[model samples]
Target: SNLVYDWVKAAILFGVVNTVACLDHLDPPQPPKCITALYVFAETHFDRGINDWLCKYVYDHVGGEHSAVIPELAATVATFAITTLWLGPCDIVYLWSFLNCFGLNFELWVQKLAEWGPLARIEASLSVQMSRRVRALFGALNFWAIIMYNLVSLNSLEFTELVARRLLLTGFPQTTLAVLFVTYCGVQLVKERERTLALEEEQRQDKEKLE
Candidate 1:
């Protein structure tokens, strides 16, 4: 079960990063219009429909007997992360605000952390560890995606202009902010792991004393 959960998380992260890279390389002449269309499609159809469906599926199927909150939350995060990668200037602002309001709120983190029990703690620790790796990988991929897009844009004026506009307006800022967010989350995850380890050690010591 844990292995399946881990693979699903990794798959989602990898798929989102690669999809963003592909979207970034769309036809130079049509980037502005194409990206606008994509943003509209994602917001109107994907966000309202497919995103919810995906989250529900993950919650019902993957989460099973466990609390569905974490998987659903992860799915929502992945959805926004993909949209943020593909959207334009104005939409990017709205998406970023939406994410800040719903996604990055530290209250959610506290709630997740407060859930307790030996099994729950172990599951939470493993989830945090996996998330740390995924976020780190995503951050690195985002940086390289920017670099690759820039390099490809250099060969054509139209493409260069499109890339420059998006970079100035949304791409650079969003990716940079994402990197910082991921790094912060990673640090928090490390602390979570340390806390879990300490608790486990204390329990073991107590058991020995009782024996």
Candidate 2:
């Protein structure tokens, strides 16, 4: 029903579902189907809108690449602000890229901007710088949110512990590798010490026997 209440609920659900899905696909230790489903939901539902804005706002800014801050922010802020301000029931604030959902190609934008006018160059440079910083900022926030959500949501199903255990398991191969290296070093050390001790004992016996 394009009703205000329904639209708001859909908007909120859309944000959560998309962010979770993106995070699930991030590589290495992944989440369950339920979690992955959220990602699918997000991409299918929201990506079109995002990509639409990408086509409109991003493609032109850096000459076919939405790599710079001006274009990236223009898209992110515009979409985010619009969703929050109008698309939902209540005013909710969230960054959609927190789930590793979006990546901006800053280098491409800069390369394209390399031959622009002074003002265009300045704007492009600043946008690139700002985009880098914003990426880091959103990443940190996403991590914090993940930690918080896992702590709360994993209790009944032990989902949090599962993730932690997976992290440990993923390290097992590397840890075993380091252990093997250390054991080799220890064995060499022991052999060297034994050789020195044996040589010393032999010298002492020779001296005593000679005397």
In TM-score terms, which candidate is top?
A: 2
Per-residue lDDT of 100 in model 2: 21
- RMSD per candidate (Å) reads 19.9, 23.6
Q: List the residue pairs that clash in candidate 2.
A: 8-88, 8-89, 18-42, 21-39, 69-127
lDDT of 2 at 34: 27
Clashes of each: 0, 5
Clashes of 2: 5
Per-model TM against the reference: 0.21, 0.26
Score candidate 2 by TM-score against the native. Answer: 0.26
Candidate achieving the largest lDDT: 1
